[model samples]
Target: MIIDFHSHIFPPPLIAARDKYLSDPCFRLLYSSHKARLAAADDLISEMDASGVNKAVIQNIGWASHDLCVRTNDYLLEAAARFPARLIPFIAVQPLAGTKALGEIERCAAAGARGVGELRPDVQGFGLGDDRVIKPFVETVAGNNLVLLLHADEPAGYAYPGKGAVTPGVLYPFIAANPDLKLALAHWGGGLPFYALMPEVGAALKNTWFDSAATPYLYRPEVYERAADLVGENRILFGSDWPLLGQRRCLDELKALNLSTQTLNAILGGNAAALLGLE
Candidate 1:
């Protein structure tokens, strides 16, 4: 029951016309170079097979263009439909799009989207803490019973592409405010779990989860044990951020950790299965 809780897949046309999408600042930051891998559903399925993954949550980049967001959301839904047992789809929306964004979320939820995000508020032209602007978007996600995954990177880390400003400091208030949203912060919640050592911060994170997306590049292997210690094992999800990193490689790194089989199993899939309500 190995479940990848975070991964991205683009439509073939989008990958083909990568240059066209580069006009969007976020997309440009990530994929401006031809070396940056852009995967389609087929690529994901193949990687899953090779990595022994039973299920994967296919996500979309937080596109600045509402059109790209809609188109990619459709592709994720279609991909999940095509591989019902193997893929779970999470829709993308530019929350800054106002009612249109809410409309996109409702349409996708109706079409079977289980969640919303890898949202990059920094690139999407908003702040998660901007309640006046983001409250409705967060409300819509919660109302529809969907998990929200936000792109988070540690503020103190070495600079990298796509690492716009969302950090633990920025994410805490939002997490505190939206206590009911099933929020999964990508990239180890930009190291937010570490702050959970603080009693108040831990209390505020009652409904939050963290994913190890791109962790191999960001932290040492001790991160898993330390994060679990601070936030508990159930709060972490296995996410390779595949295409950016390999599933097999991520799995290998996780397995190499000196963790109990029970804990390892929980991180590998049990937690995500429960989070997603998967049988």
Candidate 2:
């Protein structure tokens, strides 16, 4: 089964008011400059059906506002519950919310959230390098057996809408310190695999993996094979940051890479299946 590990959705009402949300001072940070297609869960289902994507993890962004986070996460939880077989819900909590965020995590987990993420520290305003700020949330997620996914930015990539400044440098310190945290860094960890040649960096990366969400816009399609060689095929997950880019875009790009069927299978679905405990 093809499991697209990264995607997003909003409630129909929210999607209908996309222009307003895109213009809101806070939400504008991610959507002001770019007007990409935003979909409701039902739209996502239709895309999945058309793309032949068997399942997808619905990623809610880390909203700095407590109210926004809860609103989006609530929809994700309900959508996942309504379509248990097709959607795996992942909630994003603002670390600034402190106890409230923890409570939100608890509530979502109880409601069947499989993970925590689409976390954008750059946008949400937190230092992942600071253990104190995120430790409680990390521990809560770990304690609950929920995977963590963080949005990533290359220190040198061209600027774009929703691009955050969580460079690999910032990611290294925290990821190294918390070896037990299960992490999947979106956008191929901002080209971090290339640094895996460094022993210490490679060691610190044992528990982390990279996802190819919005990859075509960031790098050449050959990056899929190149990254696999540097980080191992097992550490790559198939994540199409859908709506921004079609699921078929990533699928077609990867298929043209001429990789072995075993490696292809791993990138296409097996790796995410194992990480997410999907059958």
Candidate 3:
């Protein structure tokens, strides 16, 4: 089964919120209206069918205002309810909101949210490894057996558009500290696989995983092969970061990589299925 693990879908409420926020001069410069044009559940299924994708794990945008997280999550849950076979919902919670954020996580999980994140600390205005606030939230997700997907930032030298604020240095500490938590770092773990050979930093983060969201724009097409060689095929998964990067483009990028059938299959779907317990 082909599963794209990192994609975004904005419902109507989120669309309105996005419009309101984007109207402001400060916000308008950073994001484009293209983000607001996400496919709904039915549209997503149609696109997935055309692309030969069996399922997609969807997330909400990080730029959403405080109340919008819950509203968008509710919309995502409702969409998943209508098409559970095609969509896997991941709830977005803003850690800076403290207890309120935890409550949202609980509520969303209770309503069947399979995971929490695509958490953008830069856009969300928090540190990726802010232990005191995020620890409790992490524990809740770990306890519930849900995956934690963080939108990791690339190193300073490698920073590109849509990189957000999740630097590799910041993520190293976070992953090191939260050894037991299952983490899928979006955007090829912020170019982390390239640094995995470092004994001091690499050994402490065995549970870290990577999703190839926005990789086509950031790295060469051969990156998947190099990443699999460095991080092991089991730790990598396919992610389109769709609507921003189209599903067809991402799949074509993956196909262009000269990898073995086993590695290709793992990156395409096997790794995500195993990580999300879909097996």
Candidate 4:
């Protein structure tokens, strides 16, 4: 019943050439040689089994080049197909690519993609909230009821290496603008519960949800409890952000929290199953 709602896996060729092709200094710094060494599907499965995670929603790192998004989605689809019971694949779409991006999403969903993203606007160099770019993509996903997972970057209080400057301020507008899209934000929506606490914004955004990915590096365990208080338990989902942050550490941190059994179950897997229609 344990599901990691947010996890990453890359093809071996990408891992082999990660150093040579990755030009973004932030991305390069975040991806150590050690990280690249463990990007295989088999390695990820072993890690999941060790952590007692029954299933993981595998997301692609869209922070690289746009071209790589399509390739990575293909690789992720293949990986999920190889291990359907263990892995659920989420596709990545670059809005800047126009019809081609829309086409990619259609093709992948037909091939069994359950969701879309870990979409990074700062790294991907586009505005997700922009109606012109995101409208069709949103319509397509909404039409199909596919979940849209976004890599929400916020001001982390302290300046961290390899972190993007995009903040919750930027992401909130997008969420507000697109109310119909079923969205999940990574890094607990990059501290979005704080903003959602405000009356004006929270009332306006009900379709949004947060994922607990990379929580160990970012916040204390009580933050999850506080988030549940602010956003409600149904709005939260478990995400390990695997490879970047291991599954064991994230789950360990979650276990330390004094959450209700129902809340814990929802955050761990129930919400994800419901969001992706795995139920």
Considering every candidate listed, which one attains the maximal lDDT?
1
lDDT of 3 by residue, 1-279 (tens): 899998877676545556566743313534555543545666677778889999999887664455868877888999899888888999888787888888888888888888898777777777756778778888988888888998876765554545566778778888888899988888888788888889876786589889988887788888888888788889998998886777988998888777889989988999989988886
State the lDDT of candidate 1 residue by residue for 1-279, as single tens digits.
Answer: 899998999999988888988889888989998989999999999999999999999998889989889998999999999999999999889988899999999999999999998899898899877787799998899999999999998889699888878998999988888889999999999989989989999999989999999989999988999999999999999999999999999999999999999999999999999988888
Write the residue-wise lDDT of candidate 4 on 60-123 in tens digits. 7665455767878889999999999999988887777888888888889999998988777777
Task: Output the TM-score of candidate 1.
Answer: 0.98
lDDT (Cα atoms) of all candidates against the true structure: 0.92, 0.87, 0.80, 0.81
Model 3 lowest lDDT segment of ten:
23-32
Error of 1 at 272 (Å): 0.7
Give the better candidate number (3 or 4) by lDDT.
4
Instruction: Summarize candidate 2's per-residue lDDT along 189-223 as a digit string, tens digits.
Output: 98889999999999889989899998889999888
Q: Tell me the TM-score of each prediction against the true structure.
A: 0.98, 0.96, 0.91, 0.93
Which runs in model 1 stand beyond 4 Å of their true positions?
Answer: none
The residue pairs in collision within model 2 are: none
Q: Could you say which candidate leads in TM-score?
A: 1
